[model samples]
Target: TQLLEQSPQFLSIQEGENLTVYCNSSSVFSSLQWYRQEPGEGPVLLVTVVTGGEVKKLKRLTFQFGDARKDSSLHITAAQPGDTGLYLCAGIGNTGTASKLTFGTGTRLQVTL
Candidate 1:
C-alpha cells in the first residue's frame, strides 16, 4: 500500500499570485491524477500524468510527474479566486483485476481578491 502526502495542508493567497503544491509518496505509481474540489461538491479531474517526467498544462495550471514516478507537483500561475478549493493528488495502481486509487492528505487553497 502506498501512502501519499501533500505539503502545506492549507494555503491562502491573493489573486494573481503563484503557488506550487506537491504530492509525494514512497511507492511508485503507474499513473497519477490531480483533482480540485469545491465546497459541497465532489472533486473534478484536473490532469493526469502517466509517464515519468511528464508535464501537462491546463490553462494557468501546470502539472508535473517526477522522473521517479513517486512524486508530482501542481503549479498555478496567476491564481484566481475561482481556483479556491481542496486540491487532491491520487495515485493509480493496477492490481491485476482492479485499479486502486490512493489519495493524498489534500491541500486546501483559498485564493482571495
Candidate 2:
C-alpha cells in the first residue's frame, strides 16, 4: 500500500527562522503535491513536482522531489509570521485501488513575530 508520512507535526518559530518539512513513503508517487492551508480554508497548492530529483523554488520556499519518487521535502528560508499554516503532502492514488490520495498527517507551522 502507498502511504505518505510527515514529520514534525508541529513547528513554532520566530520570524526569519528556517525549517524543513519531510515526507516519506514506501511506494513511488506518479506525482507529488505540497499544499498549505489557513485557519478556515482549503489547502492551496504550493507546488507539484513530478520528476525525480527535481527541485522548484518559490521565493522563500524550496521544494524537492526525491530521486526515488517515494519522498519529498519542503524547506522554508526566512520564514515570516504570515507563513503560518498547515502543510500537506499528497500523492496520486493507484488506479482501481483508491480513487483518492493518501495525505500526510500534516505539519502545523506557527511563525511568530
Which run of 10 residues does model 2 get worst, by summed lDDT?
92-101
List the pairs of residues colliding in candidate 2.
Answer: none
Off by over 4 Å in 2: 94-99
lDDT of 1 at 48: 85
Give the per-residue lDDT of model 2 (tens digit) for 21-59. Answer: 999999988889999999889989899888999999999
Clash count for candidate 1 is: 0
**Runs with alpha carbons beyond 4 Å of true place in candidate 1:** none
TM-score of 2: 0.93
The lDDT for every candidate, in the order shown, is: 0.95, 0.91
Q: How well does each candidate superpose onto the true structure, as a TM-score? A: 0.97, 0.93
